[model samples]
Target chain A: AQRVTQPEKLLSVFKGAPVELKCNYSYSGSPELFWYVQYSRQRLQLLLRHISRESIKGFTADLNKGETSFHLKKPFAQEEDSAMYYCALKGGTSGSRLTFGEGTQLTVNP
Target chain B: EPEVTQTPSHQVTQMGQEVILRCVPISNHLYFYWYRQILGQKVEFLVSFYNNEISEKSEIFDDQFSVERPDGSNFTLKIRSTKLEDSAMYFCASSVGQGGGYGYTFGSGTRLTVV
Candidate 1:
């Protein structure tokens, strides 16, 4: 079974400080990872994907095969960045269903 | 910037009653999916649909649950008998294809409350 684990349920940081949301997965095959963000009263939106290797809103995540991790990181946290972040894995032989982590609440204090 | 849309932002139903959650995926997308998140739990996959058939479904999607693409664009999830545990935020998503690099676009989700 494919599983995703997000260790932190809540993370707090002051504005301009670096932020890292840890994520680990257990999957036999190569898996695609993604980070989804949900702001207050907004729909869940895709923040970044491992395959794209692109940064959005200054956020980036590197897929580490050896460690089986795809940690989302940002150089500096902004007050507006406060939101709930969910790490998801999409890879299984049968269908392209996503397995999501419990999610981490990030609060960037000004 | 196309997006997935779901109807009935909030639905309050009595236990054992039937409920239908509707969604309209991106116009050009080919794959569709349904997911649910309990108040404080992780998002879980319920079912996936493609080519007018069920591609996959999780254990939580039992006989009481069914999905249908009645029209060319509308996707609906029907629960025969709603249970208290069925109350959650149901999200609908879609993607171009399984192999595409694009991530699934999720709708705002329908909050179902069973009393």
Candidate 2:
């Protein structure tokens, strides 16, 4: 079965502190991994995809196949970073449907 | 920017009542999907629609659930008989899906409350 796991349900960080949200996946074949973010009263939007290897809003996530992980990282957390983060997987043996993790609620303190 | 829009930002209905959630996908998107997130739970995939037909669905999308693109741009998900467990925030998503690695655009989502 295809599954995405985000062990931490909530992560609290202070401004200027580094933030790292862990995400892991289980799938028989290679799957495209993504990080999505939802800010207060905002729609869910894609943050970054592993294949793109590009950073968005100062956030980056690298897909580690051997570890089956795609942990999102940011050098500095800002008050604006407070939101819900979800790790999602799509395509592969699982097909085109997306499978999402339990998501981590990120709270950046002022 | 073009966005996927869901109507009736929130809905309240009694259990066993049939309800329909509506969505207008990005104009150029070819793939559409429905997902629900119950409070305090993981977001779960319900179904995917393409070419005016269901291309894929998860176990959660059983007989009670159905998706239709009744018109050119609007996509709809219908629950024949909603249960208490059906109360959730339903998100509608659309993807250009021309090739691999394309991301989706999600709607603001409709929060359904089953009484």
Candidate 3:
């Protein structure tokens, strides 16, 4: 079975400080990882995907196969960056559904 | 941008009553899915739909649950008998390609509260 674990349930950082939300997964095959963000009163949206290797809103996550980790990181946290972040994994199969982590509620304090 | 839309932002119902959650997937998208998140719990997959039939469903999706794409764009999830444990935020998602790897557009979600 595919599973995702986000260690931190809540994290807080001062503005301009670095933030890292840890995520680990247990999957047999090569899995695609993604970071989804949900702002207050807003719908969940994709922040970044491992396959794309692109950063969104100053956030980036690297997929480490050896460690089975896909940690979301940002150089500097902003007040507006406060939101709920979820790590999701998708298997190689066509009809594979996403297995999501428990999610991290990040608060960036100004 | 194209997106998925869900109706009834919030619903409060009595236990054992039936409830139907509606969604309007992107017009060009072919795959539809339903997922829910209980309070403080991880998001879980309920079912997936393709070609007007269920393609995959999780153990949480029992006989009491059913899905249908009645027309061209509307997809609905019907829960036969609502339980107190069924209270959660239900999300409807759609993707253009085969799996979640292609990225999915999720609706704002419908918060169901069973009393």
Candidate 4:
């Protein structure tokens, strides 16, 4: 079975410090990975995807095929960056669905 | 700049009653999905609809759950005989296609409370 794992349920960081949220996945075939974020009282929104290879709100994630990981990172954490982040894998076959990780809560303290 | 919209941000229901959570996906999007998250839990996929049919569904989406695009603009999830366990935040999402770099757009979600 395909699964996504977000190792940390909660992570705290001081402002200006670097931040890393680890995500790992288990799947037999090639995978499409994504990072989605939900802020307090806000709807869930897409942050970034492996295929896009783009950065959003100063956060970037690199897809590591060999390691089967797509970890989200930021060079400097900001107080407003506090949010819940979920790692998701697009079920590969046709008419597929998205399998999501437990999610990690990132809190950047001022 | 289109976004998915869901009605009735919160709902209170009696167990065993039917409930419908409605959503209007992005106008041009072809793929629609329903997901739910129990308080403090990870979001779970319930069903995916495309071409006016259910393309995929999760194990949790039992016979009690059904989905339909009753009109050109509205997609709905109907739960028959709602259970207390069904209380959760239900979200609606849509995407351009099954495969794309662009991710799905999610609605604000409806919080269902069953007593």
Candidate 5:
């Protein structure tokens, strides 16, 4: 079974401090990882996909094949960044479905 | 930006009552999916539809649950008998294909409360 694990259920960071949300996945092969964020009352939106290797809203995640991890990081957290962050894995041969982790509630304090 | 729209943002029903959650995926999307999340829990995939048929479903998707794309654009999920444990936020998602690059776009979700 393919599964995603987010060790931290909640994280608190100061407005200007660096933020890191740890995510680890269990897979038999190379996996396509993604970071999705949900604001207080918004839909779960795609923050970034590992394939693109791009940053979104100052957050970037690197896919580590050996470690089977993709951690979301931000250099300077913002108040608006306070949201529920989910780490997902796209597995199976077709890779259509996404298996999500428990999610980390990031709170950026002023 | 194109968006996946869901109806009845919140619903409350009694146990054993039937409930239907509606959604309208993006116009050009070819694949549709239903997912639910219990309060304080991770999102769980229920089923995926493509070409007007179910392509995949999870163990949680039992006989009581059914999905239909009745009018080509409108997708619906029906629960034969609602249970108290059924209270959760149900999200509808769509995608172009079964590929990781084209990640699914999710709707705002319908929060269902079965008492």
Candidate 6:
């Protein structure tokens, strides 16, 4: 079975401080990783995907195959960065379903 | 930006009652999905539909659940008999391609409350 793990349920950081949200996955085959964010009273939206290798809203996540991790990182956290972040994994081939993590609720204090 | 739209922002029903949630996917998208999040839990995939039929479904989607695209513009999820544990926020999403490589557009969600 495929599973995604986000160890931290809640994370708090100060504005301008560096923040990191860790994500790990267990899948036998090649997997595609993605980060999704849900702000309060808003729908979940895509923050970034490992395949694009692009940064969104100053956040970047590198998929570490050796460690089986995809941790999202940002050099400077802003108040608006606070939200619920989820890690998701999709099988590299033949599947459209996504396995999601429990999610981390981030709080950025100004 | 195009978006998936779900109706009945909130619904409260008694246990064992049936309920149907509605969704309208982006006009050009080819794949549609239904997901649910229980209070303080992770979002779980329920099913995926394409070409007017179900393409994939998770174990959580048991016999009590069913999906249909009655027309070109709408997709619907029916829960034959809702239990108290079935209360959750149901979200609808659509993607232009398979595996969500192009990113999925999600609707605001319908909050279902089974009493």
> What is model 1's native contact fraction?
0.77
Provide the global lDDT of candidate 6 against the true structure. 0.93
Residue-by-residue lDDT tens digits, candidate 5, A2-106: 999999999999999999999999989667888999999999998999989998999999998889999999999999999999999988563467899999999
Better of 4 and 6 by TM-score: 4
Which 10 successive residues of model 5 chain A have the least lDDT summed?
Answer: A89-98
Q: B12 in model 1: Cα distance from truth in Å?
A: 0.4
- Highest DockQ scorer: 4
Kindly list the per-residue Cα lDDT of model 1 for residues B2-71, writing each as its tens digit: 9899999999999999999999999999999999999999999999999999999999999999999998
- Whole-model Cα lDDT of every candidate shown, in order: 0.95, 0.93, 0.93, 0.94, 0.94, 0.93
Superposed by TM-score, candidate 4 places the C-alpha of residue A46 at a distance from the truth, in angstroms, of 0.5
Candidate 2 local lDDT, B9-112, one digit each (tens): 99999999999999999999999999999998988999988898888899999999999999898999999999999999999999998247889899999999
DockQ of each: 0.79, 0.76, 0.66, 0.81, 0.72, 0.69
Interface RMSD of each: 1.2, 1.4, 1.8, 1.1, 1.4, 1.6
* Span of ten consecutive residues with least summed lDDT in model 3 chain A: A90-99
Which of candidates 3 and 5 is the stronger one according to lDDT?
Answer: 5
> Chain B of candidate 3 versus the native chain B: what TM-score?
0.97
Model 1 score (lDDT): 0.95
Give the TM-scores of the predictions, in the order they appear. Answer: 0.98, 0.97, 0.97, 0.98, 0.97, 0.97
lDDT (Cα, tens digit) per residue for candidate 3, span A1-110: 88999999999999999999999999898899999999997888989999989999999999999999999999999999999999999888625588999999999999
Candidate numbers sorted by DockQ from highest down: 4, 1, 2, 5, 6, 3
Could you tell me which residue pairs clash in candidate 5? Answer: none
> Compared with the true structure, what per-residue lDDT tens digits does model 5 show for residues B43-111?
999999999899989989999999999999999999999999999999999988777566889999999
Q: Model 4: per-residue lDDT, tens digit, B13-85? A: 9999999999999999999999999998889999999999999899999999999999989999999999999
- Write down the RMSD of candidate 4 (Cα, Å): 0.9
| Candidate 4 overall lDDT versus native | 0.94
